[model samples]
Target: MKDSFYKYFNCNNKEELYLKLKQNSIDTHKLGKYLKFNQEKENKKIVIRGQNKLFDYLKNNIPDRDEVQIIMFNSNMEVLSDNKFPINTQFKDILDKSYVETANHVILLSHENEYNKLLRLEMDFKLFGYKIIDRIELDKNLELDSKNGIGNCQFTEEDIINGKNKNFKEEKKKINSKELHEFMDYYAKNELLGLNIKDDRKKIKEILKIANQEKSQEYFGLITYNKDQNITNIETSLFKGGIREAKIDPIIITPFLLHQDTDGLIIFHNHPSGSISPSQGDIQVTETIEKMAMRFYKNVEDHFIIGKNKTFSFREEFLLSNYSYERSSNKELSISEKEINLKEPVKNKIKSKEITKEKSTRNRLRSRGQER
Candidate 1:
């Protein structure tokens, strides 16, 4: 029997297949969770090397001892589920129930001949965004059969012992904090700042009011690193109107990347006004983060203000010792403090009508609004 057809559709034995997955993890620089396969095609099917629920599920559902068909899905490429279905039924019905509707790709694992037929059959399903095997590479280890069908074999301990020499250590170079920070800076300025913090309708309405006024509350993030500092990371729990309260602080914006070992970090946020000033709120937030960093034994090296222009950092004005210039560089205008002229305060007018009420009422509102 031609096992190559099966190996082609699926991977080697469980351990070997897992090793291949590990290799893919190193090659693609992705988490193992992203690796997955479609077991319905040959020379391209995902082989579940170990016996687990997924393997059992495949075996139980596909009683065709000689030729078994399977399908699987994953977050990064890891098999989340290895579901099997009857070949007699249409594949679409199986997919609709087995995989998430948002799946970007579909895998097919079967014998070489069957895969060719599937390629032809899959054209009709393409309209539904069902991306069939984007690739079809041969598996030399699994020999092809001129007739019969593909062989779906199980692994024994001997297979792993045999393939030991093929294994190699993963070469991962350590990145310095500066490089990590630079990477974060680029990603945040280009992609991250655009993300709207998840907010409810009431919160969104409040932000919209500020946004409409051209002075929308801005967001700021700080990434600090120091050789001696123990606090290597700090983040604000939530943005204004983002549902953080005295009992529950807002969830800090998740960093796109974290390199705790290198003691490096990068942070950024949106400028609703398109300006870059460190507002009173911004300063308070920074101070809070700085304090948190100190508690964690990490340094608060720089606070970044991301907007239409480039990202601004607190380190730029460290020499100036001028909070006003730092705030201006961030495109944030101070509303509470008097202007440079000192004759009048900057137009830091409270935009919210509720905030404009009596001092007692405003105090109550402010108290309720402050992040815990």
Candidate 2:
């Protein structure tokens, strides 16, 4: 490494090294052709020893394929100009600070399908485009794995009596502005959710769309269920938190699970930033709740991450296989609904009353070769 340029010249920082190279003739000193600065795997210095690493690898070394390149600058890692990117589903949690709090490596994300050409124009028409989705870092003195929603988050009079180091914090898990307005709305007249916002993809998506007015913070939600997977409750205020994190501690919801109507749970939270992609924190909390759910001979049904326009379903995207789908504790066939004359009545497959247009008009339109 004596062949290094900085070693030959008695220079310190990159500025000095640059000035020296321009002033002196490199051919006169006869430096090595294969030139590179001093770089070691675990060097303690933030930059460099002989000189500073003004030439960071990621900033300088990305491939020069303009077709697939995206340039971004950041003052702090908290916010970015970009909100979403197509990345591997497995590494979704990597975006959450709890997973890899302050990573010092480049995060390279790619497309799941090569022919995912639906957004060809929106993605700058680069079918093979690449995006670096880095971690969301906290402000201040760079707290390691910072701004988390775990461990004794809320303060109480009990903490004061016990002389705990906790301070008074806002109780996040409560019905707030959204629900208050809803309660004051037509629901006061028992107009219970006039639309079907209670099951499947539509349920999570529509509910979030209505409740996602607060884009500045996150709201951890829970959909409680009985042993048979029948939902008992769905509340948004399970725990509200600032952007980038929210508490999903199983202890907070343990009482809910103990209830006779609630043996299972489905946990979720909103990405106030409008990205439906599940972060590492989301997965970790889901796993944490699932582990505790197993104790009650149950499992979390799904985790629905609410975005601005979409909802990311853990059960749908990752698949139901990773979870305990089959419950051996299910009741015997002797207790079937048919045996007790409690069988549900089958109605017309299509309920025309719910349809806004009259069936006669729709049929007439269809008869007239309506394209729609």
Candidate 3:
């Protein structure tokens, strides 16, 4: 089964990128537990796998960096990914984010010489146990000068043909801005938000038909609407996939949400097989983006799967449910600080943790360069 989590972020060679991530570290430290894969596969290093915090960070920073910049592993430890950030991206901007999956086996690419920034960066990644590969150290590993290593990763004809980067461009017909705008305005002016599911389902299906009409490959679409639900702002066909799979990504969709007026979304994709039924993979990504929307306090109105003759809606099917993440906040406590009673923001930094029936054990940890 295809998964957007495992989709390519770029065309970099996995083996070369992994060597850059693994063999090139001047110093190395480890963290977290070994776990079972969601399912087994041959050892491979994906360029980058998407995550909630990565999506959250990309919402604000991808423009400045042009792409993600951390090489880390998903919790399963099966896939190692390299994401390089810009020199100016500050550590404070992404400190202790809401992680849907744990990030470890990491190498943070940085070249900063600022003392406080370096110290803070070290302590922060140290807590998470991520490796920091600086300019000199990275240049030494790549067998090239600094910043030139990215181009060194080799690619083959097959890699480029099937790669995500190429597919995003070559999969769809190139329509000029005017042509795209006219197509968008037709639906926007028709009040797409007010359609009645009982009577207007056919009209909705007609729209999907036009959106993916005559395309032999699958592609993903994200439609953004104004806060009042009256106007359609942007309808972006983000990624094109093979005959069956398309990358349903959050970061690519985040820029639209950055517009203050855009509030609601409907994520749709066409199955070239002419079956509108949602696959397990489809269900997985719908839940993924839905949870992401909740983080922005936005709603994913529906997930639609379009086929030659039918359309399926996740909302109408009751396949998705409410997801709530308690926001970390500073507020006055009901009781004053007396004995065990805590006051505003009782912050706790967990040093170590374990779980067992008998008693929880704490692992020995190095605290600030000394073993404790």
Best by lDDT: 3
Q: How many residue pairs clash in each candidate?
A: 44, 2, 4
Overall lDDT per candidate, in order of appearance: 0.36, 0.42, 0.46
Which candidate achieves the best TM-score against the true structure?
A: 2
What lDDT is obtained when candidate 2 is compared to the true structure?
0.42
Better model by lDDT: candidate 1 vs candidate 2:
2
Which digits, one per residue and each the tens of the lDDT, describe model 2 over residues 223-250? 6665444455666667878887787666
TM-score of candidate 3 to 2 decimals: 0.35
Per-residue lDDT of 90 in model 2: 23
Query: Which candidate do you rate higher for TM-score, 1 or 3?
Result: 3
Give candidate 1's error at residue 57 in angstroms.
22
Measured with C-alpha atoms, the lDDT of residue 365 in candidate 2 is 88
For candidate 1, give the lDDT of residue 204: 23
Candidate closer to the true structure by lDDT (higher is better), 1 or 3: 3
In candidate 2, which residue pairs clash?
Answer: 93-279, 93-280
The digit string of per-residue lDDT tens for model 1 on 117-172 reads: 44544564466565553322123333223222333344333432332212111111
